[model samples]
Target chain A: MAELFISISIWPWLAYTLAGLVQVTLIVTLVAVGALVFIWLERKVSGRIQDRLGPTRVGGRFGWLQTLADGLKLLTKEDLMPEGADEFLFRIAPYVSFCASLTAFLAIPFAGGSYPFVALHMNTAVFFVLAVLGLEVFGVILAGYSSASKWSLFGAMREAAQVVSYEVPLGMCAVVPVLLAGSMDLVVIGDRQTGTFWNWYLFHDPFTFITFWVYFTCATASVNRAPFDLAEAESELVAGFHTEYSGLRWSFFFMAEYGSMLAVSLLASILFLGGWNGPIPVASLLGLTFENGFWLGFAGNVLGTANLIGKGVAGVTVMMWVRWTLPRLRIDQVITTCLKYCVPIAASMFVGATLWQYAFPNGAIFPQSAAAYQVREPWNAKAEAKSAEAARVEKTASREPVATEFTSGRTAEAAPLSARTPDPAG
Target chain B: MEAPIYWPTFFFLLFSAIACAFAVAVVVTPNIVRMAFYLVLSLAATAGLFFLAGADFVGAMQLMIYVGGTLVLLVFGVMLTSQDRFISMKTSGFELGVAVTLGVCLFVVLAYCARSIPEWHGMKAKQVSAVPLEPTAAPLGMGLLGARVDGPDRSGYLLVFEIISVHLLVVLVGAAYLARARGKKNLLVE
Candidate 1:
């Protein structure tokens, strides 16, 4: 898009900056709208689970505008800070958390392939998302410490411990799909699972099936949802790290939490469930893949975006249901689950999955059962073969007496290896 | 036509400035918690530099391990030990002066050495533009698995990798031992 703008009369810098701004704006709007909808959904889900009416009168039936109303109320409320609080840390904590959550989305592809859907097309997007997601703990810890309240401090401590420990298993579980797919690129990972529902990584093998559950559990803990939300146990810590925050500042923390929950759910869908790809290959069957014309490809991507969003919403709704249904764990129990149970289970599954992949490289669980989907040969195979052929030629060239002709540094032999290697894409 | 403003260099400068400024802030800050926060900013900016330099894997590793993991641990330590009196410990004037002098000396020497390298000065725009920004994750993985496929000479890091794994295990056990609860008398004495 920037290149298109640059091809016109626009300045290159201006075009690039504008393109970035547009992407950032889109992602920010997505998070804001996602948070609003999820909040309403959570309230309705929780209310139903608890045998009570959620909200019905706010904006017509079902209180569709309840979150908006709440946002206005929060905006109007007075901002409060404790007398003994660290002023600087107290003010910046929420933004730090929110920024971390927002940044993680930069690497996440809403729809697969090299397109304008992702804000930043990172190669190691899985690791990048995991890294940025972990940074959210800093904001919680800072908020807890700067609150100058014992409850807040305790909550922050638990949150830090729980999030840090849970990251191990969460990362391990995520790596299962990365192992199944050759590349760490989330797009490739998602693309590999295309074709059918059975082709999803969740059904790739017994280990991966188990891994999906473990990943969900760890992801739930990592995002600090219920059953593992020792960080904000109301009965114990009042409101945990955000106890001292009020009004807009308080809402930012909630936004960060909901954003991360959605992000992880989206990640899970991409990793285990066929991301963007539905149970059935609707778009592909309709002949709307990228191989089709530009308009059809765009339509396919639109459909994919909807599919991914739907899966993410379903995942969040399930989280809300679990939050209302189960009791929160104690701090010790949380630690125990992470260390004793999750870590070991994830480790065994990782090993098992690796072995399973080794034994059944074609993803066949049973000899009689056909593989769900044919694995796409890696995109770089031809490039690698070409490079090897070039290397062999270069070796032969170097061995000949003509190699001395390159000593003056003006011959083709003096060119760097990079110059010799052909780019398949180019 | 006049060459367009190099955006990569612009971003590199921006990230480097943030990183250096925050690093100085970390050193200057008296409060341990604030120092930790500044350190996080510094390290994060450094990670941005890594990304700008096209070392995405290393950059992500730095963010995850250094900024996220280690700094979180540091903040946890600061919080645990942060009593009102202990929150802001004043450095002695002599110590501060000496540290600044040494730091400046080291900076000058390092900067001089960096500038002394001929090839490091700058790359031709043509050469820079010719380089591909391909993903380094596959080569990095292969290198760790003891196959250096990126380079013509295919040496690997399997030995170093194994040694690091064993070292991490030892550190984990040692840390657990060090943090283990002792009797009340021993705790009071410590």
Candidate 2:
């Protein structure tokens, strides 16, 4: 019954559209709700971090609904347009940024196997995410350029420059994880590290451990977060490219930022840490397989999803900590960090990992036996078929007593095998 | 003996339509920044087209290297070089006429050649369906690592992949060298 419910209709494309719409809705809602919750959390966290009580008057004892109230205020505020601003581009920029942020999730696999909770289950999902993430810069660029304000233009230009430069090291860092996994499918990569915590890419090797840090630096820079957020430098550009924005539109920019923050954090989680796999294999040991009863399987998946979200949240929390703690890097310094430091480190790590993989086909640091705890029969039909063929061939070649080769033709092989048997033996 | 119009042919048609449309838009648009923006959309669509054409590796390449890296750089150039003069290039009437004449002629010849192919015209629409646009990453990877033994039963892209990688490295270094501010900044690491 559940399989029938999950199955698509005959015309595949109708199913495609339905699935795409559902995934988009899911990601959008989650991101929107997440943004609301995160905004409040950030305020609360910063408040505690800076030794003050943040927003204690909106909804409850802790002002838990402050973000909601703030959102309402933003929605009610008047929309303004500065003189000389390119009207079309200005209006479109935020949506473009917001859309780019949302679209990356279309390719990201949340849970399940090959056909996962991903919107578009493209083989090049990892590539698609990086491409879409890079596109977020365009909206910033458009917002800055079309604003007709010098500060806005400056901010946009800085963002454009920073993001483009940062993508190099980011790509290099990303390749390390892909390299280790031996496949670009995020579902495959995530599933490979299934059994335990140590199976994560961060612990794949010493080089990967270093690569994770490099990846984080690039991610921070790419997202225009603190220490690399010269584009929105408060002192210089007067809130940078988004200076012209207000109310809901301004909130849209923040939503995009937070959305992207969650995304990159998730990327780090999947690439470095074992995605949907906890520190302990309690679920595994408890006999919770996908083949288990529906309720049991669902409970297992829910636990895994919670685990993935927790890892992602931890990554976001780390980003917030870094934001509050470290001072923003200068534009030159940020570029230097990427081009000189991150790039070289990522490149060397890539090379080191390559050599390591060759020298030790099996992972040296951790046990491969643990990696194999979750048995992944990689959907390799061809390999299985070939093996089956070889087995059949061996059976045919040998002096087999009763070789009923039923790999393909059961009737033909069975009839002949029975006929070949002597009457006495029968 | 008759040759068949394979899946790649249909993909070529679809991709060419999109790539040509967006490329023409880039050429037609006068505003430099708008031109850059249009170019981004075009290149991305082209990347999609590449994926459709069973060049999954190239499609990812188109996205990662082209749209993400090159086009972003192009947009930055648009932002930077977009200071005063030449914000929009208004071509002269004569130049426009000449350009249009050549473009039409080239397109006509190409279209004529495409139509002239009997083998290409022979296949049914269903027979010419592309190598499913969904989940092309694995075959592409196999092609790259030189082990396309199964799925597509096609040859790997090792030699070209290697060359493209090397080419990308060169392009990176060259672009950096060219774009880097002279003397005022830290140009050399060593």
Candidate 3:
């Protein structure tokens, strides 16, 4: 795209900048539009779960424009500032949260192929995404401190403790997929789970199956959803860190929250749920691949993008389901769940998965697709093969002298160093 | 035709400017919490500089461990102890002078050492642009696991990694012991 613009006489830098802006605009649109839809979905889901009609009067019978109405209301509302609040930090907090959450999308590939749909093609994308997501907590902490309210301070402190504790188990569970894929690159991890539903890391083994649930539990807590959302605990802390925020500023926190929810769900899908590849492999079955033609490849990429988004949305819907189904956990219970249960379970599963991989390099019960197994680094395999051949030669060499006799028949003994050395004068 | 912009250099200048400016902001800021925030920005910009230098793994590590983990704790501590009395400190003139002198001396040493690299001094733009930014995580992971993928086979950092792990374990145990409650015996009876 940059090259096309440059060819049309635009300056090279400007062309590149334009290309970047296009990608950024697309991602921003996804986040904003996704937020609009998700807020409506959340209401609809919550209402359906409670056996009631939700937002029936807004934009039709289904209230399709309910979120838009809410957004407009939020925009026009008076922006309030508490007398004691730190003006600067109070103002910047929501943006900080939103930006950190949005930055994480840069490394998340929405489609997997030679040309992946991602803003930044990072090798350590998993690490990068996780790191950036962690920064979102800073905004909450700043908001809480700046609010000068007891509830906000308490909310922030709980958030700090909860997030810090949850990250340990979360990272452990995440590493299981990385270990299985043998790469931190999200594309590689996703590509490793191509072909069939059974090929997904969630179904890789007993350990991975268990690891998936643990990962989801940790993910839910990490994202500060209901049941583990001690930070907000609406009944207790009022509105939590954003209690003092009003108007669009307050809405930014919700946008950040929903954006991160999508981000982590997408990450989970990529890590454990086969990513852009569907359960049925419809695209591949229809001969839609880069090998066929550019159009076919483009079609495959489109299918992949839809597959990934569907999986992400499904993951979010499941999170909403869990939120509505379960009673909220106490703060102590949340911490205990992370430290005592999730940490130990994730650790054991990690160890078990490692052992399973060692026992079955080509997979155990369910056979992996040939392409998946072959994606292991060729250099590493080559080095091992080379070492094995060298060992075989050494073993045969040691036995060859014993099996056959030479014409001279001198005993096989070490030659003196001086005798073996060639004369320098010669 | 206009000369093409060198993006890496442009980003390098942008990151360095933010990093240096924020580092100074951290020292000059009166509020402790604001100082912590400035420090976070400064360290994050330094991480950006690391990325520009083609050290992606180190840059991510810098963001995760330093800016995310350590600074979060620093800010938490500041928030916990955030009385107005502790928010700002008034430094004495003599102490400021002494600190500036020490800072300047350290800066001079660092500058001298950086300038001592002859290859860095003579490197041309073409030479700089020719180097590809290959992902170092795989090789770094291999090296940590006792394989020298980037060079001739030799001793790698596996032993060092083990030693550090054990050292960290000891520190964790020590911390746990120190932080344990004192009056915890016969809790059921109590």
* DockQ of all candidate complexes: 0.39, 0.27, 0.34
Q: By summed lDDT, which 10 consecutive residues of candidate 1 chain B come out lowest?
A: B145-154
Worst 10 residues of 3 chain A by lDDT: A401-410
Indicate whether candidate 1 or candidate 3 has the larger DockQ. 1
For the predicted complex of model 2, DockQ is 0.27
Deviation (Å) of B148 in candidate 3: 1.7
Ranking by lDDT: 1, 3, 2
Query: Candidate 1: deviation at residue A272, Å?
Result: 0.4
Report, for candidate 3, the interface RMSD: 11.0
Model 3, TM vs. native:
0.89
TM-score of each: 0.90, 0.83, 0.89
Order candidates by DockQ, high to low. Answer: 1, 3, 2
Q: Each model: TM-score of chain B?
A: 0.92, 0.69, 0.83
Each model's C-alpha lDDT?
A: 0.83, 0.75, 0.83
Q: What residue runs in model 1 are displaced by over 4 Å at the alpha carbon?
A: A7-9, A114-116, A366-426, B1-3, B184-190
Q: Which of candidates 1 and 2 is the stronger one according to lDDT?
A: 1
In terms of docking quality, how is candidate 1 classified?
A: acceptable
lDDT tens digits, residue span A189-243, model 2: 7776777777888888899999999899889889998877899999888999999
The candidate, 1 or 3, that scores higher on lDDT is: 1
- For A100-166, candidate 1 gives per-residue lDDT tens digits of 9999999888787445367777778999999999999999998998888989999999988888899
